[model samples]
Target: MATRQLLLRRAAAAAAAPRGRRGYGSTAEYLHRSIVPTMHYQRSLPRLPIPKLEDTIRRYLNAQKPLLNDDQFRKTEELAHRFEKGIGRQLHEQLVAQDNQNKHTSYITGPWFEMYLKAREPVVLNFNAFMSFHPDPKSEYNDQLIRATNMTVSAIRFMKTFRAGYLEPEVFHLNPKKSDTELFKKLIRFVPSSLSWFGAYMVNAYPLDMSQYFRLFNSTRLPKLNGDELYTDEKAKHLLVLRNGNFYVFDVIDRDGNMLKPSEIQAHLKYILSDNSPVPAFPLGYLSSENRDTWALLRKNLLDNGNEEALQKVDSAIFCLSLDDFPVKNLVHLSHTMLHGDGANRWYDKSFNLIITKDGTAGINFEHSWGDGVAVLRFLNEVFKDSIGEPAVSPLSQPASVDSSRAVQKLDFTLNDALKAGITKAKQNFDTTVETLTVDMIQFQKGGKDLLKQKKVSPDAVAQLAFQMAFLRQYNQTVATYESCSTAAFKHGRTEAIRPASIHTKKCSEAFVKEPSKHSTEELQKMIVECSKYHGCLTKEAAMGQGFDRHLFGLRYLALSKAEDLPATKRASSNRGGDLCQSKAKLLKRAGTPA
Candidate 1:
């Protein structure tokens, strides 16, 4: 009785102890961890602040100045001021009140999601973004089956670590030797989850919001009329594989929620890769690339035709992995293949697709509505590191002896005449769309990050400047340019637009393009430095969530919601076309101008 009591007491104490004190045991640690859990900073992370209306107005005008002439600027300034003093103030207050009531998330979260969901354009090139991975150093590891197996095992490991909250928290370490040290981790483990962010902050490290990490696995963007929806099924344990326009699914995780053996997974993937299934005459994957509304309609048809189970399998899989049969000839070919492949062998609706070509060129093409590149890039970095450092499958590793033909299940759709025709139309539409797009690459071997750092200029700023100069030289005029800056440091934060076409850029571009011989090297260098400094400032402001775009967007959205409550005259004036003309006429009449 005494021995049993002692063992029980020890078990209870271990359970009560912090996760950092507990043993990770046999699980492979892909990422180094602090003492705190991955989501320890989520509750304490600051909310995205709504910029003051005046500050927003100032920033808006500053961003607009370079793009407009004197007359255009004057008219824009008048309209901006009028709106700010009128309905904008009320809308801003309302937005603030709304933001206050919803303290758990940023004010822009819902509207930002709505913006993406409500867009009518196809997701292929419009909404999905792709990033290619640099090939593995060993040529043998680049074999399609070997690479796919390794990535699959690595992906499941990531999902397990992330779901169990064992993965390292995403943090920007300004001073790594101090903040990223074991001493920092030991001290931080004592801090409460609520106050953990402050602890990290004191050490000059900023932890990013990990809310989007949930959508990184078992998530899909579902098509709907008017607006789409994001669906995630955390309970699903299957892995969806697309090859030669065919769909195959196999359990990567067992019923006990433990990952399947690496050998078993490799066998299943190898079986699917070897399966010489003929491509579907009307490949239904193309439907995902169609307009959202059309796809929604066709999706209903698919359900009616008894494809709900198959569709659900596709949607609920951990993530889609595509195995391409053809090799990419060059970087452009790789880009084209990864971006919007033949469309038959790709499922564009999944949160992300891990695509591997015949030459083992791998990249991720992800749907945009669920999350930003921050989450995807983190996953990519971790997976790349983990797969390379301790790969579950190697060149010499052989598949399990078990019959994988029984383990992997091929999904088939029951297509009606209408469904078949819809798919055909979708294929044609996808082809037409992709044909209009072109992929090009340029390798600037002369100077890159190291060179720019040596010159004490931001590499990104230099790249942006190059684009501005190239455009000016080509088109003989500067155009509005946008660069995305992430606001992921705040809870549920999205992104802010950084207007890169500043006055500094204009002057520098002109100096380089319009009259290069007229300016001395030192003078031109000074102008470039000025552009870089201003660009850096813009980037910082946008990342800090002080940009004007989202603020103005919120105000406009609020105003539209309250449009009916406005006075009849104001409502009429706020609209476009005839009402705008009538409002202008009334203003002219008030000013004693001829009607």
Candidate 2:
């Protein structure tokens, strides 16, 4: 009891205590479990296969019980549930085997709607950390109905469809070519009204080694939901639930039929389970959507549900982070340094971190899923070059054969000890290499600003301005572009590739080539304002439409526009660290590299 008290005390101090709730049932109470820091130990599962996309996804969800609660947080226009003044707002079929004429749908959902009705609202924050802006914050490139790129929106839809800890199961559909834009949007629709987000989990790619602390989730205590069907209406709001109960909710993709609920139930174990869990449970710890006070209530009432939350197994995801906090420890500080590193530190670091820094605003209002470290870096690079007269583009890479796409697919390796060790070693070695040459900071900006300045300021200048603040103002470093105001962010057409299927380098290529360098900063800033008119995620619709896929597409296709020809500079320097991960390390180690 004393130990528990001590832990609680520590958690209390972790973030500021909320004004109202205090104990077990308080609005911002802490859960019993400690948040598993995002750091991975990585010693275990050395032999486990580096997970494929689907496996990695499942493993991630299995560890996070009730996975729809992904890394998604919302800053509602108003704190009131119905939006006090009320402003703007606002699927089916597969007859594979039975009932060709009239197909019946069924469900077996808990009384979530009633629960939602019970919501006492000034406003409640539904911050799900697991939601990814899949295809990206920009989705125009994919089939609008979501058949093309594996973007973020559809993943959330899959969760709402089953609610059985739904994950992005690898779906393979023939990618037929189509030019009818209207037909493209038809494939990606989801009834938002039908799906209600449970909670959130800011997702991170688990490292291979640390997966052991969660191996019990592999083939463990998952309940089978069988193949239950979800029913919804026009607006997509969830109305009711039906139950088919034929399939187990936690069973593996090919393994759901492999086992049945154990007939020999142990009375003692059942007693223990029941004793621990409270029926009619709520998502422990209250939050007024997007409020920092949410952190205060994170450590209470966490349930194991007995499986890896990543969905690798049924009824067995190992719970890592419970509330708003990232699960890892001291590394959070390090992770923060890497993820939210401002100034120069921000330039050379990246991590899938959960710390929330201002989005050029006052406090925490973002879902890590919106744009984690990698996405931010990509956004920054684009912003930087755009700030110059260079065109806002990432070079596209050569397309790989479909089979190879799966073969060498990038893995979200866990940030375990081994990888950490590898980074540490690399950093040491890297420090001994790179040479630095000083460039005038203000001069660089003046030069870049003179290059941009010819566009409408409508909405996106705000976000681009946020990105711009980093270099122009924050870095105190010089960029070649200077606009009167920073352009805000918006979702642009994902039409970077002339061919939807092929990859395109983001810079120095034909697809979305970098702009040619200009003679003055003024011209650079004008191009940026013009570019901002076209891109940057300024609105919810715009933010939801884009994803990291555009960036991914670029990495794979290896094409680029001329202005972002940083690789050439590196090549001229005989350097070897232009890659995102290594580039910063190279920059950090700039002082020691041999000429």
Candidate 3:
């Protein structure tokens, strides 16, 4: 009991605590048996708190000091002080009242939503965040059909775990429940609606709000596109398969939720490969590969005609399966094919798009807006463990049973001459865009996170510092750097930007780069450790919803609120201040979001 109380105290002081300090306590006591219905703990989770205006102002000013020149920083400092004392105070009170009124939602949720949807121009999946699986070697070098069959069976079994309520809740490293900050230790129950991992999911790849997802369970591909119209036979259990700029629907599941045998799935694929009549005529999926505004306009045009039904068939699917034309044996190349695809080969807008290569390689192209890496990663780990770690049968072995009751369905679209022309243009645009991207894969075999443990340094901080140090060595100067830390420790949490390239990090990197012979190994290690410790503190604080970026967001929000109530002259002045805050906030956004 006393030990538990001690841990609680440590957690409370963690946010504002001094850096480079250790031996706080063990996390063993924080572990407890979670109750049933893992998601039941959500509504009861504590709301994310708003930091004090004074504290935010101070932290923002300090973070800026290292990044800004003398004159720019002084001007910013004066404005910050004035804003805090004058309009900023009023805004803080309003924010407090807003927080009080919004008992369920996070304080930053509304502002973040606008930024996520309306504020950002391009679609997020391709540009912001995505993940691709490494290719399965046996599948890549051998039988493609049999490998995909094994993969599908494994995936179904994994999904069954989620449906069975046997999935364990995720634990936060920090025990916020014991601290002053309210946080749920078991995060599975507290995921926000935006990041919820259950039930059927979809990804809208088109920037213009085109809903396109191929349901993986209990659906069949429709035959014939009659005048821009699409129809799917709901009774046929098939998965939508896209390959070589063509779409085919093949059965993988039955009506009673039973998975088809591997032989049955393989046979279906064989039939698909033999069919040559489905000309890759209209690369309709290629429209999604265009620029955000372009896709939006094109999607609008499609919807204006009688294309909503056709779009819905693709939009409401469980997931998409893409059979790629590439037969590469290399892992990175296979991963790239699965992730981005040759542009035209993917719908690019599904919550999950599983890619299978001709040589039997397989990987998933996942959309990021659905959930964080934690859930998806856990899902993939389970899939690989079932399929590869302990296979029911070797992918090389043929299945004993083959369900030949169903035939593979081809989805045909009815398109006008103009729509056909649009498809051609989209394919060209996709090719042009893909040609501009440069992909580099690096493998470091020496040491990884373990090296950080050996140094007693945080890996995140050290990795970030390594980049800044690299830039210093190569370019001889430090640039603003941003590292994202997960706030999933809190209810409905997303991410917080941690400015890892701080004042101390700059000093350490400069010392090493400018005068390598000056500092001894001991001295350099000590400095590096200090920087890492500071970064760890900032990350913890941000997870507790006390980071400078969100605080700045709140302050700017308040400023906007107050400006509306002011006269024209005062409003203009307030607008100018708001503009400055926005500009300053952009500097906080840097290049260190972990994939």
TM-score to native of every candidate shown: 0.91, 0.21, 0.75
lDDT of 1 by residue, 1-595 (tens): 6543232223222211122212222365234433667898888887888999888877777877777789877866776676567666777788999999999999999888887888878999988989988888888898888888888888887788877777777776656799887788788877898898888877667777889889988999999999999999999999999999999999988888888888888889889888988999989789999999999999999998899999999999999999999898999998898899999999999999999999889999999999988888878876776677677788899888988888899999999999989999999999999999977888989889999889999888999999999998998887777777777878898887788888899999999999999999999999989989998778767777877878777765565466566444354444433353244233222211101
Clashes of each: 0, 180, 11
Q: CA lDDT, every prediction? A: 0.81, 0.20, 0.56
Clashing pairs in 1: none
lDDT of each residue in 476-530, candidate 2, tens digit only? 3222221111001111111110111111111111111233453245754454444
TM-score of 3: 0.75
Residue 253 of model 1: what lDDT? 86
Ranking by TM-score: 1, 3, 2
> Which regions of candidate 1 fall more than 4 Å away from where they truly are?
1-34, 566-595
| TM-score of candidate 2 relative to the true fold | 0.21
The alpha-carbon lDDT assigned to residue 442 of candidate 3 equals 84
Pick by lDDT: which candidate is best? Answer: 1
